[model samples]
Target: MEYTEELLNEFYNPANVGVIKAASAVGKIVDDENGEIMKIYISVEKNKIVDAKFQTYGCVPSIACSSMATKMMIGLTLEEAAASITASAIVKELGGKLSDTKTRSAEMAEKAVKAAVKNYSKK
Candidate 1:
């Protein structure tokens, strides 16, 4: 199982790797398939994501997925972010394909974003 440079770069220098003290919303998801969990924090204004971050306990693919997903969310509206983030997108951003396990990384990212959005809507 070879990893791409993009994947390694994201895993090593992950972006948005923390919690927001004053976040507008927070979301979390656990991949029961792999015993991994990802929690997302976001600050939204006028339906746009002003900031995003995530904390995850998982593998390199998970980190890369959340990093890229959070970065993508930073400037997008909630709907747009939800529509675009997916497991396939993660693998594509990494410039490679993934097995089923790696694919779950993207799903985790997607779930995190959706969870945050759902929480935000409650406000």
Candidate 2:
């Protein structure tokens, strides 16, 4: 899939593209259909996310989505991050030009966030 200029920028210069060594929560999700995988690590303190990072193996859009997802979550509380993560929001944050085909990447990003929250809550 051809990515938009904004997505290309994000993919080429991804933010928070590493694992947090001592993450408070970690989440991974895979897209069997496309062989896409995303893993996110987050550090939370006092109910707030102090750090967020991700490793994505997939298309350009997948990397871009995860990059933005991490950037959006870093300073937010766990609850705020969870609520703010959505496909529509991801697309909007990508400058609102992502096509329908790439929405799965955003969905994957959302699933990763929910997984992190669920994992953190289990502790």
Candidate 3:
């Protein structure tokens, strides 16, 4: 079985796949041995996620997972942000069944959100 065209398109053409001009928090996760490097950049206002972006140099599923996670977090409150976001959620949202290797991307997304929250909480 191969990744569907729709899935591949989503991965190739991620929605928020850039860096925020002014980021409130930026997080990086890399497991060299595992070959996962996920970086997320986010901008917030009043503790709400106003803008978000991600840059990842990984497989298609990893990229797609992070990209979709960033898309889902936009316009979410700090509290609401924590409640949502998960690898399973991304997989389900993306029509399900991403390669197991890409699972780290979802964890990266969760960590990124937590990193943003931690940054905001410090202020």
Candidate 4:
């Protein structure tokens, strides 16, 4: 698959690629088919996300999507991030579309964000 320069950049030098030890929320997902796992950590303050990070073990798109998703979440309110961060949004941020097979990576990012918000709400 042909990846955009933006996507390649993110893939090669992903941002927010770590854990937030004191994260307010955390989300994790695994791709059943590929056994790829993605984990997101978010630290929220005053209803806003002060920081976000991710650890993904998968293909290039998975890592890129996770990185971009977390980067996009910073400074966004939890509600806004939850509502605005979608698979399409992640792909868009990555500068274009992903193949059908790789689209799951973006979806994983979306699901992880929602899961993190849900986890936060429960606390």
Q: Largest lDDT belongs to which candidate?
A: 4
The sequence of per-residue lDDT tens digits that candidate 3 reaches over residues 1-123 is: 466565577787898888877688876777687677877787888878888888887777778777887888889987787678866777777777666655666667677666766776776
Query: What C-alpha lDDT, on a 0 to 100 scale, does residue 114 get in candidate 2?
Result: 87
* Clash pairs for candidate 4: none
Per-residue lDDT of 41-66 in model 4, one digit per residue for the tens?
99999999999999999999999999
Candidate 2: tens digits of C-alpha lDDT, residues 1-123: 556777888989999988889799998998998999999999999999999999999988889999999988988999998999887788788877777788889999999998998899999
If both were scored by lDDT, which would come out higher, candidate 2 or candidate 3?
Answer: 2
What local lDDT does model 2 show for residue 32? 92
TM-score of each: 0.93, 0.95, 0.84, 0.97
Any residue pairs clashing in model 1, and if so which? Answer: none
Top candidate (TM-score): 4
Which candidate model has the greater lDDT, 2 or 4? 4
What does the lDDT read for residue 103 in candidate 3? Answer: 64
lDDT of 2 at 105: 90
Whole-model lDDT, model 3: 0.76
Per-residue lDDT, model 1, residue 66, is 89
By lDDT rank, best first, the candidates go 4, 2, 1, 3
